[model samples]
Target: MSHIFPRHSAQSYPVAVGGEGCYLIDDTGKRYLDGSGGAAVSCLGHGDPDVTEAIKAQLDQLAFAHTGFFTSAPAEALADLLVEHAPDGLDRVYLVSGGSEAAEAAIKLARQYWVEKGAPSRSRLIARRQSYHGNTIGALSAGGNEWRRAQFGPLLLNVSHIAPCYEYRLREAGESAEAYGLRAANALEEEILRLGPDTVMAFMAEPVVGATAGAVTAAPGYFKRIREICDTYGVLLILDEVMCGMGRTGSLFACEQDGVAPDIVCIAKGLGAGYQPIGAMLCTAQIYDVIAAGSGFFQHGHTYLGHPAAAAGGLAVVSAILQRGLLPRVQEKGDALHARLMEQFKQHPNIGDIRGRGLFRGIEIVEDRESKAPFDPSRRIAANIKKAAFEAGLICYPMSGTIDGKHGDHVLLAPPFIISDDQLDELTDKLSQALNAVI
Candidate 1:
């Protein structure tokens, strides 16, 4: 009997004793391929020497320095590197501990920005349905995932939700992808008008939907239209790149590929490459200036904000990614991985769709291909697939509630950037076995 509390106490779990390259080893000495990088955190894979060394070096020198008192070299350097690589106008970085923290900071910053600019009425937030910002209260209120928000509805602040740009399920038969994209993106405009444009502070979304929707990508021109809407309404665009940014999408920032620069962006998970927990919210110079000139302070701080060791790990991870030219490699491997998945599942009746970009891919499951019907939620297809994959020496990220709050299932694949072709082949093989055994 273990004294430690677990995520799910009803079920036992393997103790992950060690990790190397793209695989994790259990206490029993079994190696499981990290197919989803533990929810897309380990971009450089496990046991990265450079990142580990950076963390250790930072710890040796100094571990904690409160932001109110001082700023460390690692924090400054990390911020500089991130800004240099960030989208145009995004000149400031507010470092935080993880995805939820990043989201919380972004929300507060947006509200503060509006207030500083004399738009105190801009307090409402609009996000897409089926999207996930984070788990904290403020972030949770901004998120639109039904299951996650259902129980917390009473406690959550009022936030509006519009339809997401999910083309596969929502796209009409006669509609071109571009047309559907425009239609979906137009939902924001309608929502803004309904809520009174002056009252809305920001519109939040994940450039590439992760976890909740399983690596879903927006259609062409979708984000361009979204950017246009934000600008037209004076609404700040906040892109939550917690799972898809930092080279996971084969681009430094996923929004770059979409050719749109958000006013505020939240990033995490892959930022530190699982070497250390770190996340940051980047905002435009205009927003920063408004708050700086108005309040002379942002009115937010965390005990671990600008943590030296985490910043060091993030800096090292970004440095290694750029030095090794891993972004292009992610694109190349992603192409190979997509091809392998298509080849393997193209003929499978239960596999409904295979889509995504770079190392992040999703395999949507269905009971009938023609109808695109989901399996019974009670059947727990995604859960069974995850268990089967793990038992077969592969760790995957599978989740239910894909269609809404309770209906669909998808397996999200986000292998480490360091994964090889052979490892991809292994991933597909194990996935096929898991699907066959469970689905």
Candidate 2:
């Protein structure tokens, strides 16, 4: 018996011993194609020499440095590189260990910014339903995934959740995608008015909703209008790009495709590409200036805020994404993957919608395509599909509670940028097998 505390206490899992390009090897030597990049973290696939070398070199020089006392070169360089390519107005970076830390920091920073700006009343937050930010208390409260928040309701801070800009189910029958997006975006304004704009500090959302909603992109003009509303209300827009940023969504920053730059942004997952755990929260110059001019400290921290080796790994991963021309490649390959998924499942009776951008795609499963009704929660459709995919030698991300917190199912596909055409076919073939075995 193992002494480790597993994610699922009752379920047993195969031991992952090693990984290559896009496949993970189990203890028994079974090669499972990594269809989801292990929750969209390994963008460069299992092993990359460049990132490893950088981390190793940094460790040899200096493995750790507490931020309370000093800042290291790797941390400084990483911050500079991130800001250089970040969206306009985002001029500062706060490095952390992972997505949860990033989200926590973003929340605190938003609140503090308002306080420093003489708006302490702006302490409330607003987010979208069916969105997943991170797992920390503050992040969890900001996230609208009900299933994840149910048990912790007593401890969570109060947050207003508006309807998600999900076109598949939320858009009316005759509404155009663009019109539906505007209507959806207006919900934020309504909520802000209901809560009073001055009482709200930030509006947080994933650029491409991940995990909970499974790669759900906003309808056209949704984010643009959202940005406008934030500006009008003096509310900060915080984009959580934890699972969809980096090069996973074709663009280095997912918000770029939406043509909107947020006042603050949280990024992780693909930032370090599974080489080292790293995430960052970036803010605009205006937000930074207010705090700098007021207290000179943001008043939030973590022990590993800027670990030298983790910073080195993130620096290398980001450099590889930019220098190797992976951004365009992600776009090209994303189109290919989307086309292949459509070709394979578009006509199927059970597959309701196949959507996403870049290498990040999602397949919503429905009992009836016309009604878009989900499989019964008791059926455990997502869990079974995941098991079947794993058994078929493919590693895919399937999740329950897609529509609400308990009604729908979806499989999120986020393969590495280096995935080849042949591998794409392999992925589709194995996914078909899994679906056949399940639904």
Candidate 3:
């Protein structure tokens, strides 16, 4: 009976009428705890007063201002704050409406940067398998998630994919973490050489792989090696932090934990905490300078590139996170949540892995703990778990195709930064019950 088209056509969904703190209320007055923050977007939880106020103030003053003619205060201020805290050498910001836009912009910018630097042949992009950048054609092309790219393969640009730094599945026995990391990182070097290094424009990756792999973090020295590989080939390194950034992983930027800096970074999702749609692509001074000196303008734009309302929401969210010291709080809560999961599920025969950083954690479900074999994709275990959890008045992010965009299942937990210990306990209890019922 609903006119609005939903993601899944056949399934009936509850009407989300309102939100308060970490809970969403349906029209029938049922309350569901937002355990995954609606795909890890709502970091400050729902109905935050500060973010609400900021949006209201922006609307009162001005709502939309096209970026072609002018830039609003909120947009300027947000860019300044982001640049100030960004990794070394990244001195510019390009705002967009969402994660896919930001990722697309990064790709275009990388291409243009090389062109401006007189390397027009550098057009190829190399990303890791089992990685996801975004859903748009360009971003989707950059991503290695096979299922998403399968039907749209012809529309996507030609991009090469290498092995992901997935230690759990790819690491060989008798191999040290560092050794496996080096071996995995070497894949990029091999790909670059095979592609003819000069023809490669960039190497893109998620510091901690999100959706496609379920909050998978890179091995200890993996990124350091990636940085070296990019530098060796003069290839730009673009880190897609749309899902893992913005303090989801205990740090303001996930790359901080890896001890490596990328040439360009894309961030979204938690940037505006779901209050408004906002995403940004930040780049190093060198890349900016190349474009500035050559064309004086990056050849790209969208109508709602820097809407004042979205900028205000993002600025306020960042302000609230810093003012309330939520970054450190995420670390504390993340530790507690991990410990609770381990204590509860370590002996559970189907739980294969409990791993992640900060509030962003993933529980990989397997058929046999001894073999770490995934549940049959035909079982649709992740979908069943999600539906069961929602029916039980809980909202968790569960996804299938964890192994190769077709097999494996995982539940990604990215509770709000404001979540309390009690809520964490509730999340675990609901999740445990859901998994039990499904498996």
In the range 238-346, model 3's lDDT, one tens digit per residue, is 9999999999999889999999989999999999999999999999999999998998999999999989999999999998888899999999999999998998798
**TM-score for each predicted model, relative to the true structure:** 0.99, 0.99, 0.99
The parts of candidate 1 lying over 4 Å away from their true place are: none
lDDT of 1 at 58: 94
Candidate 3 structure, TM-score to reference: 0.99
Global lDDT of each candidate: 0.95, 0.95, 0.94
Q: How high a TM-score does candidate 1 get? A: 0.99
Query: lDDT at 305 for candidate 1?
Result: 94
Residue-pair clashes per prediction, in order, are 0, 0, 0
Residue 267, model 1: Cα distance from true site in angstroms: 0.4
In candidate 1, what are the lDDT values of residues 1-439, reduced to their tens digit?
8998998888899899999999999999999999999999999998988889989999999999999999999999999999999999999999999999999999999999989899999999999889999999999998888999999899998999998899889999999999999999999999999999999999999999999999899998999999999999999999999999999999999999999999999999999888888999999999999988998899988899999999999999999989999999999999999999999998899999999999999999999999999999999999999999999999999999999968999999999999999999999999999999996
